[model samples]
Target: MKSRYILAALLATATVMPVASFAQQSAPAPAAANPASQIPAADKQAIQNFNLTDDVFNRIVKVSQEAKAQGIKPKDAKTDFSKIHSLDDLAKQVTDSDPRIAPLIKKYGFTPREFLLANLAVTNAAIASEAKGNPRMAAYVDQSKVNQKNVAFYEAHKGQINALMNEEPDPAAK
Candidate 1:
Protein backbone atom coordinates (compact mmCIF):
# COMPACT_ATOMS: atom_id res chain seq x y z
CA MET A 1 0.00 0.00 0.00
CA LYS A 2 1.04 3.59 -0.46
CA SER A 3 2.40 5.25 2.63
CA ARG A 4 -0.52 7.65 2.70
CA TYR A 5 -3.04 4.82 2.63
CA ILE A 6 -1.10 2.95 5.28
CA LEU A 7 -1.12 5.93 7.58
CA ALA A 8 -4.81 6.48 7.01
CA ALA A 9 -5.58 2.81 7.60
CA LEU A 10 -3.60 2.87 10.81
CA LEU A 11 -5.53 5.83 12.13
CA ALA A 12 -8.88 4.42 11.11
CA THR A 13 -8.11 1.09 12.73
CA ALA A 14 -7.05 2.76 15.95
CA THR A 15 -10.24 4.78 16.09
CA VAL A 16 -12.52 1.84 15.30
CA MET A 17 -10.88 -0.76 17.50
CA PRO A 18 -13.18 -0.61 20.50
CA VAL A 19 -16.38 -0.27 18.53
CA ALA A 20 -15.46 -3.03 16.11
CA SER A 21 -14.61 -5.36 18.93
CA PHE A 22 -17.94 -4.72 20.60
CA ALA A 23 -19.86 -5.27 17.40
CA GLN A 24 -18.06 -8.57 16.89
CA GLN A 25 -18.78 -9.84 20.42
CA SER A 26 -22.44 -8.92 20.13
CA ALA A 27 -23.48 -10.53 16.84
CA PRO A 28 -22.73 -10.85 13.18
CA ALA A 29 -23.60 -7.87 11.01
CA PRO A 30 -23.07 -6.55 7.52
CA ALA A 31 -19.67 -4.95 7.11
CA ALA A 32 -21.02 -1.54 6.20
CA ALA A 33 -23.85 -1.53 8.71
CA ASN A 34 -22.51 1.52 10.47
CA PRO A 35 -22.52 4.50 8.18
CA ALA A 36 -20.07 7.34 8.65
CA SER A 37 -21.43 10.45 10.31
CA GLN A 38 -21.44 13.81 8.62
CA ILE A 39 -18.66 16.07 9.79
CA PRO A 40 -19.80 19.35 11.32
CA ALA A 41 -18.98 22.63 9.59
CA ALA A 42 -16.83 23.77 12.48
CA ASP A 43 -14.77 20.62 12.23
CA LYS A 44 -14.39 20.97 8.47
CA GLN A 45 -12.96 24.42 9.00
CA ALA A 46 -10.78 23.24 11.83
CA ILE A 47 -9.29 20.56 9.65
CA GLN A 48 -8.70 22.92 6.75
CA ASN A 49 -7.26 25.67 8.91
CA PHE A 50 -5.10 23.46 11.09
CA ASN A 51 -1.36 24.04 10.90
CA LEU A 52 0.60 21.39 12.73
CA THR A 53 2.55 22.42 15.76
CA ASP A 54 5.59 20.35 16.73
CA ASP A 55 4.11 19.58 20.13
CA VAL A 56 0.82 18.44 18.64
CA PHE A 57 2.61 16.30 16.08
CA ASN A 58 4.70 14.67 18.79
CA ARG A 59 1.65 14.01 20.91
CA ILE A 60 -0.27 12.46 18.03
CA VAL A 61 2.57 10.09 17.22
CA LYS A 62 3.10 9.14 20.84
CA VAL A 63 -0.60 8.65 21.49
CA SER A 64 -0.99 6.47 18.39
CA GLN A 65 1.80 4.16 19.50
CA GLU A 66 0.55 4.11 23.07
CA ALA A 67 -2.92 3.23 21.83
CA LYS A 68 -1.52 0.23 19.95
CA ALA A 69 0.57 -0.81 22.92
CA GLN A 70 -2.50 -0.58 25.11
CA GLY A 71 -4.22 -3.12 22.86
CA ILE A 72 -6.06 -0.93 20.38
CA LYS A 73 -5.72 -2.97 17.21
CA PRO A 74 -6.02 -1.86 13.61
CA LYS A 75 -8.80 -2.96 11.30
CA ASP A 76 -9.54 -6.63 11.65
CA ALA A 77 -11.96 -8.81 9.68
CA LYS A 78 -14.79 -7.63 11.89
CA THR A 79 -14.13 -3.95 11.24
CA ASP A 80 -16.55 -2.18 8.97
CA PHE A 81 -13.79 -0.46 6.99
CA SER A 82 -16.32 1.92 5.59
CA LYS A 83 -15.15 4.76 3.48
CA ILE A 84 -14.78 8.02 5.41
CA HIS A 85 -14.37 11.40 3.75
CA SER A 86 -11.84 12.91 6.08
CA LEU A 87 -10.08 12.71 9.40
CA ASP A 88 -13.06 14.62 10.78
CA ASP A 89 -15.21 11.55 10.31
CA LEU A 90 -12.75 9.35 12.17
CA ALA A 91 -12.44 11.87 14.97
CA LYS A 92 -16.18 12.27 15.32
CA GLN A 93 -16.77 8.53 15.37
CA VAL A 94 -14.04 7.82 17.88
CA THR A 95 -15.13 10.61 20.20
CA ASP A 96 -18.81 9.91 19.81
CA SER A 97 -18.54 6.17 20.33
CA ASP A 98 -17.08 6.65 23.83
CA PRO A 99 -14.35 4.21 22.91
CA ARG A 100 -11.38 3.47 25.17
CA ILE A 101 -9.16 5.04 22.51
CA ALA A 102 -10.49 8.49 23.29
CA PRO A 103 -8.89 8.47 26.72
CA LEU A 104 -5.48 7.75 25.22
CA ILE A 105 -5.81 10.74 22.94
CA LYS A 106 -6.73 12.84 25.97
CA LYS A 107 -3.85 11.38 27.93
CA TYR A 108 -1.55 12.96 25.37
CA GLY A 109 -3.39 16.28 25.87
CA PHE A 110 -5.40 16.24 22.62
CA THR A 111 -9.10 16.14 22.20
CA PRO A 112 -10.01 13.66 19.44
CA ARG A 113 -10.92 16.62 17.25
CA GLU A 114 -7.60 18.36 17.80
CA PHE A 115 -5.64 15.17 17.32
CA LEU A 116 -7.36 14.46 14.02
CA LEU A 117 -6.64 17.93 12.77
CA ALA A 118 -3.00 17.62 13.68
CA ASN A 119 -2.92 14.21 12.06
CA LEU A 120 -4.32 15.57 8.83
CA ALA A 121 -2.01 18.57 8.88
CA VAL A 122 1.09 16.53 9.47
CA THR A 123 0.07 13.90 6.97
CA ASN A 124 -0.65 16.53 4.38
CA ALA A 125 2.67 18.20 4.95
CA ALA A 126 4.50 14.92 4.64
CA ILE A 127 2.62 14.03 1.48
CA ALA A 128 3.24 17.46 0.07
CA SER A 129 6.94 17.22 0.74
CA GLU A 130 7.13 13.89 -1.05
CA ALA A 131 5.02 15.19 -3.92
CA LYS A 132 7.08 18.31 -4.49
CA GLY A 133 8.56 17.05 -7.71
CA ASN A 134 6.17 14.25 -8.59
CA PRO A 135 3.39 15.44 -10.86
CA ARG A 136 0.77 12.74 -10.35
CA MET A 137 0.78 12.73 -6.56
CA ALA A 138 1.26 16.50 -6.49
CA ALA A 139 -2.03 16.86 -8.35
CA TYR A 140 -3.81 14.85 -5.68
CA VAL A 141 -2.86 16.96 -2.65
CA ASP A 142 -2.23 20.70 -2.79
CA GLN A 143 1.42 21.24 -2.02
CA SER A 144 1.38 25.01 -1.74
CA LYS A 145 -0.43 25.63 1.53
CA VAL A 146 1.40 23.01 3.58
CA ASN A 147 3.33 24.49 6.49
CA GLN A 148 7.05 24.50 5.85
CA LYS A 149 7.93 23.75 9.45
CA ASN A 150 5.65 20.75 9.48
CA VAL A 151 7.22 19.49 6.29
CA ALA A 152 10.66 19.96 7.79
CA PHE A 153 9.65 18.06 10.87
CA TYR A 154 8.32 15.24 8.72
CA GLU A 155 11.53 15.12 6.78
CA ALA A 156 13.59 14.97 9.95
CA HIS A 157 11.45 12.28 11.50
CA LYS A 158 10.77 10.29 8.37
CA GLY A 159 12.74 7.25 9.40
CA GLN A 160 11.12 6.96 12.80
CA ILE A 161 7.64 7.37 11.40
CA ASN A 162 8.27 4.79 8.67
CA ALA A 163 9.53 2.35 11.25
CA LEU A 164 6.44 2.79 13.34
CA MET A 165 4.17 2.33 10.39
CA ASN A 166 5.93 -0.85 9.36
CA GLU A 167 5.86 -2.41 12.80
CA GLU A 168 3.56 -5.38 13.29
CA PRO A 169 0.31 -4.63 15.04
CA ASP A 170 0.51 -5.60 18.70
CA PRO A 171 -1.15 -8.99 19.15
CA ALA A 172 -2.48 -7.88 22.53
CA ALA A 173 -4.74 -5.53 20.59
CA LYS A 174 -6.89 -8.53 19.78
Candidate 2:
Protein backbone atom coordinates (compact mmCIF):
# COMPACT_ATOMS: atom_id res chain seq x y z
CA MET A 1 0.00 0.00 0.00
CA LYS A 2 2.78 2.40 0.83
CA SER A 3 4.57 1.39 -2.33
CA ARG A 4 1.58 2.45 -4.35
CA TYR A 5 1.65 5.98 -2.93
CA ILE A 6 5.37 6.29 -3.51
CA LEU A 7 5.00 5.08 -7.05
CA ALA A 8 2.43 7.78 -7.69
CA ALA A 9 4.64 10.51 -6.23
CA LEU A 10 7.61 9.42 -8.28
CA LEU A 11 5.51 9.34 -11.40
CA ALA A 12 4.26 12.87 -10.75
CA THR A 13 7.76 14.16 -10.21
CA ALA A 14 9.13 12.24 -13.21
CA THR A 15 7.58 14.81 -15.49
CA VAL A 16 10.11 17.41 -14.36
CA MET A 17 13.20 15.15 -14.23
CA PRO A 18 14.32 15.95 -17.77
CA VAL A 19 14.31 19.68 -17.15
CA ALA A 20 16.08 19.15 -13.83
CA SER A 21 18.77 17.18 -15.66
CA PHE A 22 19.25 20.04 -18.08
CA ALA A 23 19.51 22.54 -15.25
CA GLN A 24 22.07 20.44 -13.37
CA GLN A 25 24.28 20.05 -16.41
CA SER A 26 24.30 23.76 -17.18
CA ALA A 27 24.27 25.16 -13.67
CA PRO A 28 28.03 24.98 -13.12
CA ALA A 29 29.14 27.26 -15.98
CA PRO A 30 30.27 30.80 -15.24
CA ALA A 31 27.39 33.26 -15.43
CA ALA A 32 28.85 34.99 -18.50
CA ALA A 33 29.54 31.70 -20.28
CA ASN A 34 26.13 30.22 -19.57
CA PRO A 35 25.28 27.31 -21.88
CA ALA A 36 21.55 27.80 -21.56
CA SER A 37 21.88 30.80 -23.84
CA GLN A 38 22.74 28.41 -26.65
CA ILE A 39 19.31 26.90 -26.47
CA PRO A 40 17.50 27.93 -29.65
CA ALA A 41 15.13 30.85 -29.35
CA ALA A 42 12.26 28.73 -30.56
CA ASP A 43 12.80 26.12 -27.86
CA LYS A 44 13.08 28.74 -25.17
CA GLN A 45 10.00 30.43 -26.46
CA ALA A 46 8.09 27.16 -26.37
CA ILE A 47 8.92 26.61 -22.72
CA GLN A 48 8.01 30.16 -21.86
CA ASN A 49 4.77 29.80 -23.71
CA PHE A 50 3.49 26.85 -21.71
CA ASN A 51 0.79 27.63 -19.12
CA LEU A 52 0.04 26.35 -15.61
CA THR A 53 -1.56 27.66 -12.43
CA ASP A 54 -0.21 27.83 -8.87
CA ASP A 55 -3.06 25.69 -7.58
CA VAL A 56 -2.28 22.86 -9.98
CA PHE A 57 1.43 23.33 -9.50
CA ASN A 58 1.23 22.91 -5.73
CA ARG A 59 -0.99 19.86 -6.09
CA ILE A 60 1.44 18.13 -8.42
CA VAL A 61 4.34 18.80 -6.09
CA LYS A 62 2.48 17.55 -3.04
CA VAL A 63 1.15 14.45 -4.74
CA SER A 64 4.49 13.52 -6.30
CA GLN A 65 6.42 13.94 -3.06
CA GLU A 66 3.92 11.91 -1.10
CA ALA A 67 3.99 9.20 -3.74
CA LYS A 68 7.80 9.13 -3.81
CA ALA A 69 8.01 8.79 -0.01
CA GLN A 70 5.56 5.94 0.03
CA GLY A 71 7.63 4.06 -2.53
CA ILE A 72 10.97 4.37 -0.72
CA LYS A 73 12.46 1.09 0.33
CA PRO A 74 12.74 0.31 4.05
CA LYS A 75 16.49 0.05 3.70
CA ASP A 76 16.63 3.27 1.67
CA ALA A 77 14.05 5.11 3.70
CA LYS A 78 16.61 7.60 4.85
CA THR A 79 17.45 8.68 1.30
CA ASP A 80 17.17 12.38 0.63
CA PHE A 81 14.81 13.57 -2.08
CA SER A 82 17.67 15.38 -3.83
CA LYS A 83 19.64 12.11 -4.00
CA ILE A 84 17.07 10.53 -6.26
CA HIS A 85 18.44 12.28 -9.33
CA SER A 86 17.11 10.24 -12.18
CA LEU A 87 13.59 9.37 -13.26
CA ASP A 88 14.68 5.79 -13.80
CA ASP A 89 15.71 5.48 -10.14
CA LEU A 90 12.27 6.67 -9.11
CA ALA A 91 10.63 4.32 -11.59
CA LYS A 92 12.66 1.37 -10.36
CA GLN A 93 11.45 1.81 -6.80
CA VAL A 94 7.90 1.12 -7.94
CA THR A 95 8.70 -1.78 -10.28
CA ASP A 96 9.37 -2.36 -14.02
CA SER A 97 6.96 0.34 -15.18
CA ASP A 98 4.42 2.56 -13.50
CA PRO A 99 0.84 1.47 -14.03
CA ARG A 100 -0.64 4.03 -11.66
CA ILE A 101 0.22 7.24 -13.49
CA ALA A 102 -1.97 6.72 -16.50
CA PRO A 103 -5.05 6.82 -14.32
CA LEU A 104 -3.97 10.05 -12.65
CA ILE A 105 -3.33 11.61 -16.03
CA LYS A 106 -6.71 10.44 -17.11
CA LYS A 107 -8.29 11.76 -13.95
CA TYR A 108 -6.91 15.19 -14.72
CA GLY A 109 -8.15 14.83 -18.31
CA PHE A 110 -4.68 15.63 -19.55
CA THR A 111 -2.88 13.90 -22.36
CA PRO A 112 0.70 12.94 -21.54
CA ARG A 113 2.17 15.90 -23.39
CA GLU A 114 -0.18 18.34 -21.68
CA PHE A 115 0.73 16.91 -18.32
CA LEU A 116 4.41 17.23 -19.24
CA LEU A 117 4.02 20.83 -20.36
CA ALA A 118 2.28 21.66 -17.10
CA ASN A 119 5.08 20.00 -15.16
CA LEU A 120 7.71 21.90 -17.15
CA ALA A 121 6.11 25.22 -16.36
CA VAL A 122 6.01 24.44 -12.66
CA THR A 123 9.54 23.03 -12.60
CA ASN A 124 11.00 26.04 -14.39
CA ALA A 125 9.40 28.33 -11.87
CA ALA A 126 10.80 26.17 -9.07
CA ILE A 127 14.34 26.15 -10.50
CA ALA A 128 14.26 29.89 -10.96
CA SER A 129 13.08 30.41 -7.40
CA GLU A 130 15.78 28.10 -6.01
CA ALA A 131 18.54 29.89 -7.92
CA LYS A 132 17.79 33.33 -6.54
CA GLY A 133 20.43 33.56 -3.79
CA ASN A 134 23.26 31.27 -4.95
CA PRO A 135 26.10 32.64 -7.08
CA ARG A 136 27.01 29.22 -8.42
CA MET A 137 23.52 28.91 -9.82
CA ALA A 138 23.51 32.29 -11.57
CA ALA A 139 23.21 30.71 -14.97
CA TYR A 140 20.20 28.73 -13.87
CA VAL A 141 18.80 31.88 -12.36
CA ASP A 142 19.03 33.55 -15.75
CA GLN A 143 17.39 30.57 -17.39
CA SER A 144 14.75 30.59 -14.70
CA LYS A 145 13.96 34.19 -15.47
CA VAL A 146 13.35 33.22 -19.05
CA ASN A 147 11.21 30.33 -17.90
CA GLN A 148 9.22 32.62 -15.62
CA LYS A 149 8.67 35.01 -18.49
CA ASN A 150 7.43 32.08 -20.50
CA VAL A 151 5.07 31.09 -17.70
CA ALA A 152 3.66 34.58 -17.75
CA PHE A 153 3.29 34.40 -21.50
CA TYR A 154 1.48 31.13 -21.01
CA GLU A 155 -0.90 32.69 -18.55
CA ALA A 156 -1.66 35.51 -20.94
CA HIS A 157 -2.36 33.05 -23.73
CA LYS A 158 -4.10 30.39 -21.69
CA GLY A 159 -7.05 30.02 -24.01
CA GLN A 160 -4.96 29.21 -27.05
CA ILE A 161 -2.70 26.90 -25.05
CA ASN A 162 -5.67 25.03 -23.73
CA ALA A 163 -7.08 24.68 -27.21
CA LEU A 164 -3.84 23.27 -28.50
CA MET A 165 -3.48 20.90 -25.56
CA ASN A 166 -7.04 19.71 -26.02
CA GLU A 167 -6.47 19.09 -29.70
CA GLU A 168 -3.43 16.93 -29.13
CA PRO A 169 -4.17 13.24 -29.50
CA ASP A 170 -3.40 11.10 -26.51
CA PRO A 171 -0.46 8.76 -27.20
CA ALA A 172 -2.23 5.87 -25.50
CA ALA A 173 -5.16 6.29 -27.80
CA LYS A 174 -3.04 5.88 -30.89
**lDDT of every model, 2 decimals:** 0.56, 0.45
- Runs in model 2 deviating more than 4 A are 1-44, 58-96, 143-145, 149-174
TM-score, prediction 2:
0.43
Best by TM-score: 1
Please give the distance, in angstroms, between residue 68's alpha carbon in candidate 2 and its true position after superposition.
7.5
Per-residue lDDT tens digits of candidate 2, residues 1-174?
A: 223233223334543443433454623554234423443444445555665665555455444443343332223333234433332333343332355554554455654445554655655654554455566665534463345664454455556433432332233432
Best by lDDT: 1
Clashes (N, CA, C under 3 Å) per candidate: 0, 5
Q: Residue 73 in model 1: shift from native, Å?
A: 1.7
Backbone clash total for model 1 is: 0
Per-residue CA lDDT of model 1 for 1-174, tens digit only, reads 322222344354443322222122334454455432333445445544676666776776777677666655444323333645455556665555437667777888977667766765556555667777777655545434446676777788878777777666666654
